[model samples]
Target: MEGTIFSIIPALLMLVLVLLTRKVLISLGAGIIVGALFIHDFNLFGMVKEIWFIFYEIFVSEGSLNIGNILLLSFLLLLGIMTAFLQASGGSRAFGDWMIQRVKTRKGAQLMSAVLGLIIFIDDYFNSLAVGQIARPLTDRHRVSRAKLAYFIDSTSAPVTVISPISSWGAYIIGILGGLFAANGITDIAPLEAFIKMIPFNLYALGAVLLVFVVAYFKMDIGPMRTHEQRAIKTGQLYDPNQDNIPGDLGDTFKPHENGRVFHLLTPIGVLIIATVLMMVITGINNTEGTVNILTIFANTDVNLSLFTGGLIAVLTNLLFHLQQSKPKANTMKIIIEGIKTMLPAIYILLLAWMIGSIIGTLETGEYLAGVVESASISPSLLPFLFFIIAGIMALATGTSWGTFGIMLPIAAEVTSISNMDLLLPTLAAVLAGSVFGDHCTPISDTTILSSTGAGANHIDHVLTQLPYAIIVAVAASVGYLLIGTLNQVVLPLIITFAVIIGICLLLQFLVKTKLSDE
Candidate 1:
């Protein structure tokens, strides 16, 4: 319950240091240390002890078992296992070969990547790693820029998951809403129903997903993206020499077995997807109290357990397939363990993000920000737009969408209850949409980092190239919220939102011509 000024200091330091140094770990570490010192009243030794205690709780104590961290870490490890199996079994290479046949143009490559990302909507972490691993070879073969590949994966990852009903994002948001409702004693609106109602109003997610389609289908590129794409096509370089430090071998790294079949790759991925759905279905049935509809079952299911179990089954299925199909038959156990090992870096990063989020929670920065929002004389008609912008800024500053959701949902729930109950759905959607919008825009976001790692794109290159597109989506989404706040028609606002998105994209396409289009 610190004042807003003290609560915001650590966050500002985090953002400023990261922006100036581009060293996320070091910057965050410094900010955390400073926050500790402040909390301990500038007692240097006490501050050290306090910080150590925080790390101990995060890394060694039961803090690691928190549901949010567990789901994210599980997804990352599962992705590692799947991607490693795909690569080791030549599934990725064979899949790439198959893609090259159908995806002859650069647009096809990018669109395919986006489609794959959308298809794997169970979790954003899984989507980014899997799609990037599968799309890299295909995109490279077609001379598509890696930054564009990163954008395809990054944009689709969080946005699609946030908007997906069966996704971890959905489950988490609902859980947050559930807490907010129960605490506030708002009996009129059920959390799950409210979340579902809010989906269509999640303008940012829709804008982002549709923006990808528009950009790729129309061959439109803007800002640094245009320069990167032109240089890539003109020079046959996937990365800029100055900004990109990728090893030369990354593009040519995939090599399939001499007799590898596309089925070798497809079977496991197919199994994984099917298994995930089945797990959710069965888990829902088991958890049900009485007769329930499909939507209720989905809302009641445990997303983390379902995802982990499905991922494990997929890995085993792939191992069996590799054992049966590969000529010499690779070491299934070794490959499995090695594949899991491939995710250690991402795992550590997730751990850091979780720890930082926990620290921010301890500082009560979110509560302070929520108070600031509450203090504002924001009109009922302007609430959705204001909430969207405020939530976007919070997520952008913190680089943690889940944390942002935890912070904003309660405030949104309070605001809707106190002022205009009809604004509930739109306000909730704005919070979710803005969180995702900002998450993709920030360089320190774990998903953004994973997207770069998966696409083999330089981190800054990915962030820089993707921001303009994200801005366009954010602007359109904010306007959608404005329309919702005033007119309060979901369908009409969505239609108008897309119209604005398309118009902006079209204008950008004209203003930013592709240098290679002439060639």
Candidate 2:
């Protein structure tokens, strides 16, 4: 019990800080400090030394740029730079202007923005910033508050990435499934093959996407989100008290420069998508051996080179057409630099997140947590549900999906073997679902924070408004997983379960409306 308490101290500390002050960065920093202190047991010198060692291991060790951490960091940087460039070139603003020209109603703008987020299923970080930056002006023009916009963006980010097979997240999913296979003594299956099999089992991710569509198409309102949405429509005012008397605001400022064009915006993003897919295919082919497979190519290859190549191509394409037609060459450089600067805060936070994850790894918290779960001797029949719940709790507590997946994936595989279960799909699904659940609710989570920032919603406000919806979907997903496990059918039963869940929630809303009218 004492060991377990110590192991979870960082998580507890983080939650306390967040609730007390509503300062996410401070809360995360406090968690990291607590974890370090736990490692050192109040010895000041020992804590300092451990911190130094953890930092060194993360930045300088051979394992530092391992597939999971490297891919995570690479995607974040790419997103930051891409977003910055898009804004700097006036491409995003141009796109927004073009979108507004097409959509006359608030519902149409909201629906279009949601659809765009769904299409950009590359990385959650990319999805959040891109959708927020592009749709903010239009949503605001239609009197959609940043909170609602952020909610839509946040809803799409993790849900879309987990379901897509050709994303930065796909690589992580592959890695986790591979570990599960190795643990279960199933060495014959390739990682990619395992990943493919598990897709149908990822119920929560699929359900969340369905939920987003339902909410958008029907304009369903629930809890605080419903109130905010109505207020935004009626008065064009966000729920934030601080949003008074600001002129040329988030909406007004986004008016496009007269010189902006579609090519200026589309070219770089197009190049990025093409380059990423081609590189992934190239790496996958090079890494394949006879019966054995070398999955390291996903991590070991120069992801930075790929991102830089794509970004540079986009920038060049933008300058050649747009800049040459309007501004001088010097002005183009300034735009690009400014774009990069816009993503700097996200970049800094990402680096800190990586460093903190490394420190957690050093503390062996995953191993300790795994021990506790195993000792509990949970039934095999209940393993899927248990896995989902535990993974969710861990992720929520730690405020990181990557960390949750990294810790749980290997342990889940071990449990599968111990119970003589098919380890690949179920374990993968558990990790993915759990990670997303935590990412959804944890106030300290980067995705959650980014969503709030992107939408111009107060971080706490976003979390508070989003929690009940997340819970509704999560409970539905839990039932869906149980049916999947019991029925042993992959997609059909799960799909039906998801539909039923959403239907029930919508029905309840109707009932509530009828009751209110009767009263």
Candidate 3:
């Protein structure tokens, strides 16, 4: 028991660091170091050896070849290359310029930004950075706050990716559910089929997206967001005047043609979308034997290759389309290199996150957590809700959804199987939803940090302002999950859950408005 407690000290330390200082990389590094100390029992030489072993395992050995991380990095790299190319060719700028010409009001600009986020449902990282880069200037011109812009970008990130089937997140869900199905004695169903079955039950992800649309369309603001919005309106300084201004200069270097052709912008994005879809299909086909198991494909296929292939297609389209005018040869190379450079920080963080997860895995922390939960003998009926809440807390505390998923999914799968509950889909959904919920609110979450960076808001400022809204949504999602688990009926439960969620949001909006007015 003492060992178990000691094993978790690193995770706890990480939480304290995030809450007190909000320095993500430092927090993550501290967690890794603490975890190593525990594993090595304060043996200085052993700790050093462990660090070397972990680094080599994660970056050089077979562990580095893990499909999920490879897929994630590949997509990020491709997104970087494509985004750079689009900026260089003036595609994103041209579209933004056209939208600016059409949208006359602040509300209109916000709506357009939300709509674009919805449409670009490829991946969370891609959505967060792309939407922020494209819409920030437009929203700024319309007097939207950096906080508000960050909120929009952050809201769209997980919410959009979670719902979209073509996204890298979708692939991960398929992989996880596939494992759950096999473990639960449902051997015949294909991975994709299992994933599709869980879609209706993914209340949080779907509900979050719906909530974003509702909030945007109704022009609702609550809590700190309300404060920030009003500040933007009164000061007329929507964009952060003190932002680093590097991306802006980078943007200027890639000025689009005077003609502002929409095709120039649409073509590359379209190619990227189509190529990614085709690659997924090919991967699915190549891995699917007569058995149709999802894990087989996840374990076998090269996800990085797929992403690289898609990115190559996108880059080629950009070069081919832009070559008709002045050759952007130097600009093309610069854009790709810049895009890759932009992703370096995220890549490094991801590497650290993976290393931490690997350490935790070696310690069998999930098994320990599961043992404690099982021994508590919590009511089986309450298991689903408890799972949802626990998963959220863990993810929030850890500040990494992928890490949360890695820790919780296997344990949740075991729990549902042992209990003989028919809540397999709900359990998986709970894990995914909870992880994302935690990621949404966590001060140290990379997604949150990226959103702040993209929106040019102070990282802590974004976390401080976004926390209330995230909490509100999380509460709603918890209730929704409870209903889905208890009611055991899909349609009626969904309706009630959505209605309650919306109602809560409305009530919160009213309270927020009243408070703002009082102030």
The candidate maximizing TM-score is 1
Pairing residues by index, what is the TM-score of model 1?
0.84
- Model 2 over residues 314-368: C-alpha lDDT tens digits? 5566556554555432355555555445445544555555556655655665566
TM-score, each model? 0.84, 0.79, 0.79
Ranking by lDDT: 1, 3, 2
Global CA lDDT computed for model 2: 0.67
Candidate 1 structure quality by residue, lDDT tens digits, 1-519: 254568678777877776677666666787778777777778999888888887677535663545644665676677666766677677767777788888788888888888998898877766776677667878887889989999999999999888776776777777688888888787888878877888899999999999999888988788889888989899988888774234112333334456667777778767766777788778877877878766557667766677677778887876676676646344666565665665665455555555565566677776777788988888998988998988887887677898889888888889888999889889988998888988987766878878876786776678889999999988888888899999978998899899999999877776555544765
Per-residue lDDT for 414 in model 3? 79
lDDT digits (tens) for residues 1-519 of candidate 3? 223755566777876786687565687788888778778778888877887888777545663455555656666666666656666666666776777789988888888777877877666665665567567757876778777777878888887776555666777767676766677676767867766776777666777777767767787777667767877888985544553332222434465555546677777766766776567557866877765444444434444566566667887887787667575634556777877776665566566766676666666565566566656766555666777777777666556777677668777777777774677667777777777877877665767766765665656557777777677667777777777677765677567667876888888778867876999
Which candidate number would show the highest lDDT if scored against the true structure?
Answer: 1
Model 1 lDDT at residue 121: 85
On TM-score, the stronger of 1 and 3 is: 1
Candidate 3 lDDT at 283 equals 81
Q: For each candidate, how many residue pairs have backbone atoms clashing (under 3 Å)? A: 0, 0, 0
Give the Cα lDDT of each candidate. Answer: 0.77, 0.67, 0.68
Show model 2 residue runs off by greater than 4 Å. 1-3, 48-90, 129-137, 175-179, 187-194, 227-231, 234-256, 276-305, 319-322, 325-341, 420-424, 444-462, 484-496, 507-519
Which candidate order results from sorting by TM-score in descending order? 1, 2, 3
